[model samples]
Target chain A: MEDLFLKLSAILTGFDDLDPKLGSLYYKELMKASGPPFTALLQTFSSKVLGHAASTGHPASADQPAPAGNPEDLLRENIWNVMDFQILSQAIINLWYTATLKLGNVTWVAPPEAYFDSLLWRAIEAHPPAVSGGYFGYWRYPPEN
Target chain B: MDKNYDVIIIGAGVAGALIADKLAKKWKVLLLEAGEKGRERVELVGSYLTATAQTLGSPYKPVPAPAKNMAPSPDGTNDYYDQPPGTENPMVFKSTYERRVGGSTWHWLGNCPRLLPSDFKSNTLYGFGKDWPITYDDLEPWYCQAEKELGVAGDHEQLNGLFGAHRSQAFPMNRIWPSYSDLKVAEALQGAAQQWSDFNNEPMVLFCTPQARNSVPYDGRPVCTGNSSCVPICPVGAKYDGSVHVNKAVANKATLSEKSIVTRITAAKDGSITGVTFIDWDGREHSVSAKLVVLAANAIESPKLLLLSGLANRSDQVGRNLMDHPQGEGLCVSREPLFPFRGPPTTSGIDKFRDGAFRKDFCAFRMSMGNDGGGRTQSPANVLNQLLKTDFGASLRTKLREKVIRQFRISFLAEMKPLPSNRVTLSSQVDDAMIPRPKLSFNVDDYTMKGFDRIADVMRSILLALGSKPEDLVLPNHSTPFLAAGHIMGTCRMGTDPNDSVVDAECRSHDHKNLFIAGSSVFPTGGTANPTLTIAAISLRMAQSIDNQLKMSQT
Candidate 1:
């Protein structure tokens, strides 16, 4: 479960060196926080990707080394193998952006850790405007290039 | 037994808080709010820091009431307001405002432009909408007072006769520095005179807009630091909100009851308001009687309460003539990097079209330049959604950064003439608390739509001048092209005649002598400016009239 979680995290974030321990922690918290639906999606994603890699002798196989190129490229290449994987991919991305899960009409807010670690801050290249991470008038300066 | 007070002001928004702060010095005052008192400033700032979506109402927790403007409920079960089925332009009439302790100012942008002289006499000048009983001159002193109270910062040099608002005093503080985007656009527009002309062919000029936020640390608040978060929450308390005056009112011996949703107002047979009844979150009812009652519960809720109580309806104008600054926005990429999304959301605007002979043909508008650095229009999330469909790896990051920095948006807030047909009425349905929900019927007339078309032409011209191809300009759709400025006004309109208007010059109801109404609800015509400054000025004037009347009764 931990290895699959690490591989999924690497594919989603496009980062190969993502700490396996951090991925395991995020996976455990996501399952505990979001419950059955999120875990079920993960299970399907693992089976489709890993099962295909084993049959086709792809680098994603457990017996072989991981792909050397961008994980996103590898996932994009094999994304069509799973049905509705794009929806699951977007759901995972939404969790990173809003720290929440939207199952149908209902939305469930993720835990505080997920919210604090959302990738939205890094994408915007600025801390939340309401709680300035710097002194007054710090925004007057250009953001770090 | 019901508690008695000298004065009871419904809604603890800016108007109510100001009135309470002023009148509480001599008269016993009670402020009733429908929402919670909200978290402390520090806690609220923290909540804003971690919010995934920094929407206007994100910092404050949702109050468990049927405020239709809040988050709309799914399944169509819980609604804040009820409109007739197939209402024309439902989105245009859909307004958003907070019902918390400080009311909508919790998310106001602090843009403080005074209404021009023609704004008060729109009927006489343009033969459309009713004229205000009071002129800019009558409210000029109060505008100064409101500016001082709100700690307005502005450049006196920018106060040309463009809007015809003469200021007796300079702003309380110096003007906030314009953002990089504002400077870039202003510089570019300076040379393009032929492209930016008004109806009379007068050259349109860009000037720094007067703002209510602090620029030099007046009133114990720090200067605005350009956090670009002025709308949702000002983390450093640089921008003014109703909480400042609410706190002052509390210090001056006014009792504020939060989470107290005012349900109905009682009036005597002699056409005088007697008392008010409110319900708590726990469904407990409380009543308070007062010598005078002021309904400051915004434009929507105040009228809803009147309709529910069946009071102040003699003129039958209690909920008629609803007005809001219907706005249209256009987005484009500047030829040069404007670096938007950096300073306060807006810092400058073009007031050339605020009033003119074009009023005979179409509505007039105030054009404002946005400065939020692409956070609103083209956020990283939106860019990623578009980029991820094609690009991968480092190319994705490169495209996102390049596209975001060049995005710019400009919006026009057009003045809509008050029509008796566009209104707020009580629906047959009721909420769980048995309170009637407000039903709004609104439509954008051809006059306003024509004005949007003209503004679109001007916007395209401006974008072309800023080094954009004509094809790159995005014009608003005329069929459905209005965004609610949240400047709800004219429902409880003030006028000299009692036949057509709901309130008199003093914002006192024509049917009830002691019943005064504050806030933008009493605005006869909301010129193209944002209505908060005018709301504050009129509220201060109303507070003075109430004070004088109370003093004379003792004599």
Candidate 2:
């Protein structure tokens, strides 16, 4: 179940290096947040999308697009275009990027480690706000990629 | 007799904490707070990490809830005051203060800019707001002292006389290095960028803003690690907060009573403050006697207390002239990748607009360069919200990187002219404490609107100069134009005339000699700078006067 959810997150977030530890946390959180539909999202994504990407030996990358920037365009037309699947997919993607969930109409935040492990921070080459473990005055220079 | 306190401070905020620390060794001072005990740094950092709203007061929600008997101070999420009937811009007061032992500094961004000398003389120079009874020179030494007490990090060489504001002593530590985006913006605003606005042809200089966060370990605090969430909580105890002095005062044998809310100050028939009656967290009433009483409960609450007690309103100036620095922002994409969301929210700002002959027309404004890209605009959400609109997988990641790397923003904080009408009065409405809540009557005048127009112009010039196309510039929002700076000043102001002001230059009530008030409530006319450092300086000076007065009485 964890493996399948992570695979879906990787394909959706476009970041192949999603933290497995955080992946488990995000999976549980997204499952609870979106309910039974989240289970269907994983099953549909795995059967329809993950199988093709796994066989290809590489997930979708900007270097190569599938259809309309997605390969075979199967992912967008079948899943991304479908409102129900798209909603779950977008929530999964947002959870991986920000580690925030809106449950019970209140912002349910992830653990501190989850905030630090956010893929969006890695994507932008910046650390999480207020948790910069970087040295004094490091902001004076451009962040090293 | 053994429990008698020489001075009993009303609120344990920055001003109250500093005064308590200064006099704790010499006198038996009692530091009273309307909220709970100060939380641990690590605990607060963890609370902030999980708080969904991530606002100034989010870290305190997990702590004990506010007692029913306590005066109200909440996180900046809901409306705390109501506008009078038929008030035009009833958007409500935007800034919020905390109800914690450390006061509102827990959520402050920690930028500490001193008011320019001209800021004190704006009334005489600009023919606008009233002049301060004291001069910048009188506060210069104290400003220097306050910088040391607050552990300010600043470039003495760059800021010493940028606008003719003198720093007699050097900053305690070197300036915080500007963010990479600051260096980029500084370069972009040079030469041809100066021509972007014919309105003010002067070159804009982007120097590091002086801040209370540490550069090196000082006063037993750790050095700053450039945590981006300085506003909500500094994960490390690098940024100075009121709790530092509150603890120091405690260590020096001064008493601290958290959740002991002072509802009404008891006074003699002679108009002299005798003592104050307070309610503990359990709602039990207690009164403590004091020779001297200090009101340090911020701009709004201090006046509310005075009105509640019916004391020190002989001048009828308890809660008049409420002011806050009306602020707004502009965002765009930079041609060069200026990675943001590091360091403090603001590392550098333009000093040119903070003062000028233009004050004769509109109010002055200070422009801050945001290190947090698309700051309140939420660039990460902006990308994801725009994401899956088209692409998924690798393209989404690539798009986020591309968009976020180039995100940039410039915020403008415009000065507000203090009007007697923009006041805080006691409301018929009562809080859980059964005390009258503060009813606000506030508005933005045309003078401030003109400053907003200039801010729009400056943002246009700078963004255009940075090679950003006109189409890419996300300018100001007209409907919700200005933002609340949280630098609330001028509710019980100080001046020479007893008839026009509540307190004197020493912050002693003109009507009640031994009664003193602290914090930004005493500011006569606010300039474009943040009020914390000035609050520290004035509070320290007021402590000296109180000590001298006590010594004279003993002699």
Candidate 3:
């Protein structure tokens, strides 16, 4: 993954500057590193920006802790998930903005996480307070007022 | 002869609902509701436009109008009537109360507090407001029964004059959990009570006010999620709507006739209520016979129904002594963000001044502060300014959103005593059905004002103690026409005698052997606390009385 990021970084940063042979070599390496389905560029962005917090392993928690289920653990996992998404999503959005400027239109820029983040935040505020204000702001709407 | 129903109950609010549920086991019961069952009303329920209804639009649509133009609404901007006072009668002005199957419960806050012991004998002790025929001791058992029946959740251990009434059972459920704001005010007042020790030293205690609303899973109902929007409907079935009980009664085999707007009570030659005549919304009239009749149509409508039926006119006090708790609103902003929109409507209250040492003229209690954020801004001038300032696009939305929303506010709900002069009467003008509309002529007396001022001072002091700035406080004036507190009580007051009042100790009307009244409308004086608890208590006793009467007639 690290090697793919380095190679993808080289291509995105200075695709015009690379020799034809070097550029083809880097492109082949990107394809191999990313595996099937997702492009090397998408994988690099997701791992660095969106998946970073989940990799850190702070789990999320449940909205309401009931006696029946492992409600407490559920609550914790939910919290981690929410925090992970917010931080990762925002970071990726920021990285995309920078990456897009350097890569130009020659390469695709993934949709910024800020769009999804804003939508989620709006929904959270509109929801009842009890549902949103769980541990670590899981499903927590940003303060509207 | 084929006998009619054992009891004919009117209205389907908490009072009528409970009584109907109890009586349906043996006696055939006829429950009359003016409106359809579970009808959705968008206005009362909040909307997405702001998640609170736009206050503008057609104000009323009662089969008969609500209390004509009693006073302008509490916000104090619009006239209750389309025209000035004399041009249109006040009774037919606008609808203040809900008229659907559950009645106003759909819009009620669901606070079910019991009246203080002193409130029962206000006339005897304070020399104001008529005394209840029954003592606090007499109604204690039934109070417990009512709490159980209504699925009340309260901390009985922290009740006022706890020893005054002996309960056979504990509350059906526990007290409601406090919102962050409820805890804050309660803590502040507890300290203030100690400071004002000279004012009788009851040590202003704060506890969760008992509410018909669920706090935990009870009787198949869900627990309250602290919606804080109890005044309007709870879209989630967590808060207790009176219709829950109405539905229970129907499940228990109680007969319900809806959309049958009752016009009058038809009596036999002996003055026994032979039947009731009602007109449907489609202009079709139908008469149904019953052996016994009950009037639980609330303070405003109950008396109007009686007057229309010509049942309780002998004393001329049928609907005369209408009363409501006069609120003295004191709004104060906090230095720290309280995040007001994140909790229950009210979770805690100060009860130090609920009774003892306070004269009849003065009454006071601390009401729970609400979350100030999230609800829409209805200040017309502010809305008008936005229209004048900007284009009607994204900028306008952004500006309106920023200006209208406030994240913090704490308000005070001071207590008021019921005076004889404050009342509901029939108006001169008739509606489409030819029945005179209900008129409310009420004012908060100087005594109530004094009590409010004193309480307001204390609240301001408490707010300051909690790091609020001097400029943060705003005291709303109640002298100008504003709303009477939604807690309406006392019109068909309960007493010992048929001559002095309408009903007996058990809420049975004196004149008619079979007629009974349920709810706060039978209260002798509107107490400082919410009356839903006491109303539920009276409903239990009423059901028993009706049952006993049925047994005797069978023998």
lDDT of 3: 0.57
> Could you give candidate 2's per-residue lDDT for residues B428-500 as a string of tens digits?
8777777777888788778888777667887888887777777889877457657788988998999999999
Candidate 1 residue lDDT tens string, B1-555: 339998999999999999999999999999988877867776776666555566666678652334542222111212466765575434436567887788888788999999999989988998888889999899999999999998888887678455677888888888877767776777787787454334677766777789988877788888787776787788778899999999999999899998788888998877678889888877888989998999999888889888888887778888888888887677777788766556688888888888888897899999988875443456656766786565543455556556666677888999887878888897787766677677788876788877887888888877777776666566677775466677878788898888888899999989888899999999888788899999999999999999998888778
Regions more than 4 Å wrong, model 3:
A1-145, B1-3, B38-95, B160-168, B186-194, B201-203, B373-417, B477-482
Q: 1 or 2, which is superior by TM-score?
A: 2
Model 3, B37-70: lDDT tens digits are 6334433332311222223222223323434322
Please say which candidate is ahead in lDDT: 2 or 3: 2
How would you class the docking of model 3? incorrect
TM-scores of all candidate predictions against the true structure: 0.87, 0.94, 0.71
User: Model 1, B352: alpha-carbon shift in Å?
Assistant: 1.5
Q: What TM-score, to 2 decimal places, does chain A of model 3 have?
A: 0.20
Q: Stretches of candidate 1 above 4 Å error?
A: A1-25, A29-117, A134-141, B42-55, B62-78, B87-92, B191-197, B373-378, B469-472
**Candidate number of the best lDDT:** 2
The DockQ values of the predictions, listed in order, are: 0.25, 0.61, 0.03
